[model samples]
Target chain A: MTRFMDVHHGMEGITADQLAQAHQADLAIEHEENVHFEAAWADPESGTVYCLSEAPSAEAVQRIHERAGHKPDEVHPVPLQV
Target chain B: MTRFMDVHHGMEGITADQLAQAHQADLAIEHEENVHFEAAWADPESGTVYCLSEAPSAEAVQRIHERAGHKPDEVHPVPLQV
Candidate 1:
């Protein structure tokens, strides 16, 4: 599995709890797509949401997000970690 | 310029102010390398830090981080934004 980081924008004013709820919604169906969301971070002020996950491909990550009703603005492969 | 997101780990218990200071330190030298750091997000509990920037290459991003004293575990190009 490869690590991926996806971004969601236009989420200005989103609360942490709301983001968590969305994450939970994703988690509820992620397994069907072979994706596992590991963590999420949100900057309510910037309206940006970031999610880290392990998935077979970026497409799988996007699919999971799409099903959860929040398509990512970008999905990039995390090639390194320290 | 392409947008990139980089992650730093093992930052457990770091405060938002500290991260901002580190980010400021990076900004202090970013111009020398033609990198522009746009935003940063930190999850203190998870020891995770994410930075968004515009740079010529991921290597440039790493160089900035290296100079600022914190090397990212991974730097990925942000290919899309919505």
Candidate 2:
């Protein structure tokens, strides 16, 4: 599996509850894509959210997020980690 | 405490060993700034490195990276998390 970091923009003013819900949305169906969204963090003031996950590929992560109703602006593959 | 995602560029072709060393450098001195670098991931092809940390502030993260000899190109504050 490869680690991925995805970013989403234009969610300004997102609250903690909202962020958790969005993350849970992805988690609920992530298994179908063989992806695990480990965690999500956001700068509510800037509406920028970052998600770290382990997936077969970036596309899998993207598809999961899209189906969860919060598509990412970019999905970066992070194959090398420490 | 806040979660910060910092990015570093221009280290193309970085190897796993090199990445670990770089991350260790930050970990070695993170406590001085009350920062804990949780993990680091990189894409050698893109030379993009992302550092995840819990810090008192974004500035503290930047300072730690700078002191550790891999100053970041960007440090984003992620105050809301899930």
Q: Which candidate is the best by TM-score?
A: 2
Docking outcome class, model 1: incorrect
Candidate 1 backbone collisions, by pair:
A12-A47, A81-B73, A82-B73
Worst 10 residues of 1 chain B by lDDT: B73-82
Evaluate residue B18 in candidate 2 and report its C-alpha lDDT on the 0 to 100 scale: 96
- Which regions of candidate 2 fall more than 4 Å away from where they truly are? none
True contacts kept of each: 0.00, 0.91
Give the per-residue lDDT digits (tens) of candidate 1, residues A5-73: 777889887875788789889999999989999877665655777788899999999999999999999
TM-score of every candidate: 0.55, 0.93
Cα RMSD (Å) between model 2 and the true structure?
A: 1.4
lDDT of 2 by residue, B41-62 (tens): 8988878898889999989999
Q: Enumerate the candidates' DockQ scores in order.
A: 0.06, 0.81
Q: Mark the regions of model 1 whose C-alpha exceeds 4 Å error after superposition.
A: B1-82
Residues B14-47 of candidate 1: C-alpha lDDT, one tens digit per residue? 8756887898899999999899998776656557
* Per-residue lDDT of B53 in model 2: 94
Q: Please give, as one word, the docking class of candidate 2.
A: high
The candidate that wins on DockQ is 2
